[model samples]
Target: MFKAIATAAFASALLLGASTANAMIINGNFEDTATLDPTGLVNGNKLSNLATTGSSWDVFTQINGWTTASGAGIEVQTNRTLRSVDAHSGQHYIELDSHPRPNSNSSMEQEVALDAGKYELSFWFSPRNDDASSNGIEYSISDDLVSGFITGPSVSPLTSVGAWTLVKALFVVETAGNYTLAFAATGKQNTLGGFIDTVNITAVPIPAAGLLLPAGVALLGFASRRRKRA
Candidate 1:
């Protein structure tokens, strides 16, 4: 029992010494504006306000941690434009329709370097318009490049207009490598809806080895403590 107490103490000490996480994938919250400017998108270049069915919106190809996979570019909006809907979290959010007007049918993705483990993808989704068909979005996490389709995550927008719904999907990475996490507009592709925000991907809780590592350290520390006490 004494040794067990010592182990626990040692483990706690080690945890305290550990530094904060240094993980892959940035701008998960879409708040990293040092790269893209949102103000330039005022009523952005849209054909129908896109948000309102008869307005226009601008498309900015540069988002901090995301890349445009299709369509004209990525459409970002503020409360000042379109549906005038507030973001799910920060001051900005994404609309997948993008530019080229009518129905850009856009796709935006971010590449992440991850190790072999279970990871979960999460985001808040909402519809720009009441039309359910136009609000569809299909999220996929596939192997980096190589045109592979890995069905994962359901972040499709709901019908409540500005009512954002949280969506999550869990998937496994067989081997450590770069992977593509993408979101594309589905259904009608009317360039009017499908809003995404607070996008995040994180490795699931550590597997068995994770627990064993700290336990191993604890055992060593307990042994050393025992020798000292003796």
Candidate 2:
């Protein structure tokens, strides 16, 4: 009876560990941008000359799976016009600025299906060369705010460009539902604020169960030896 109970408990622990290891978020890399219209905003108005003075248009719509929850719409930038230097990965990335319009806040968000568990979220961010020192962006999970920042390496066409920086956060979901993962631009918004790429979400590893696997195996081996001696 004792051996049976121990085996059952160990098996349950292993199953829990495996389930929590499953990744729930998809397209965290921001690489799937098939729905984005690179030409202009949702209003079908192009910025005219994006390479010159930046765009004056505000995108108040969705880009791929992400939507503009607040402020001006989000801008999808490619490295074609020499506007962007290097993308964190892939050929596309998102520019979180409303540019040509000062003090304007632009936000982008995506709703993901989540299970009840604690999750670790991570993404890469960078500042535009034209980004103002006073302007910044905020990261949020659901309605809970995570981190805020305004300073980073600038990816400007005029000055020396810098590499992207990784940002990480942790949040808990008490219920299974669609949760919003959002990034909002704050402060004195201009044509430059923040850039985002390579978003990732993973379940936080439960160390207790992870450690139990080897211990459980050792216990089973010891039990077998006792049975042989008996």
Candidate 3:
């Protein structure tokens, strides 16, 4: 009887560990208080922190949960900007391209460690301009930066403006370690780019675990029945 109880408890614990979805992205919604400008204004925009060094656009060295991965820094946007809309969930979002005055596109990356399994990454993307040449963002989950940001989870010549779109990508991990999850601007290197927000990553339940889920349930039921009889 004691052995049976121990086995059942162990199985239950494993099930919980395997099935729960964990949110990996920190400060994902960009709502966490960012380093604010002293006068609540930047480059004629509402109020936000400056990027690494660009004086023509809005960028940041760090946010609530992420840091600047490449090319100056992370571009941030608020609904208070000229000809802009509200963020997907929070008060701020991201722009892949920064500095309209002839600068290369930029990227931001976050690294996450995980066990061998499947995971899902999702975020909200919106175009800031109506011109097709202005909106393009490429996203990837890999250890190294994607080759020139050539990827599918990307927007090229994205013309739809001010409309928020949900983008979800699945990642299959063969070994447990740190993985780089990144987003970069593609197409023209113009200042205009895709707006990103509500970034989130979650682990997918293992198929093998699913096969054992029924067994875990049955064992739990059997354990309950035995307890009642005792």
Root-mean-square deviation of each candidate, in angstroms?
A: 15.1, 16.2, 14.8
Between candidates 1 and 2, the one scoring higher on lDDT is 1
State which candidate has the highest lDDT: 1
After the best TM-score superposition of candidate 3, give how far the Cα of residue 43 lies from its true spot, in angstroms.
Answer: 4.3
Cα RMSD of predicted structure 3: 14.8
Minimum summed lDDT over a 10-residue window in model 3 is located at 216-225
Q: Which stretches of candidate 1 lie over 4 Å from their true place?
A: 1-22, 36-57, 82-84, 144-159, 206-230
Determine the C-alpha RMSD for candidate 2 after optimal superposition of all C-alphas.
16.2
Model 3 lDDT tens row, 84-109: 45677755678767764466577887
Give the TM-score comparing model 2 with the true structure, all chains together: 0.63
Clashing pairs in 1: 44-57, 44-58, 45-57, 45-58, 46-56, 46-57, 48-54, 48-55, 49-55, 49-56
Please give the CA lDDT of all the candidate structures: 0.57, 0.54, 0.56
Q: Write the per-residue lDDT of candidate 2 for residues 33-70, one digit (tens) a residue.
A: 44453446543544333323454333536656677787
Q: What is the lDDT of residue 190 in candidate 3?
A: 72
| TM of each candidate vs. truth | 0.65, 0.63, 0.65
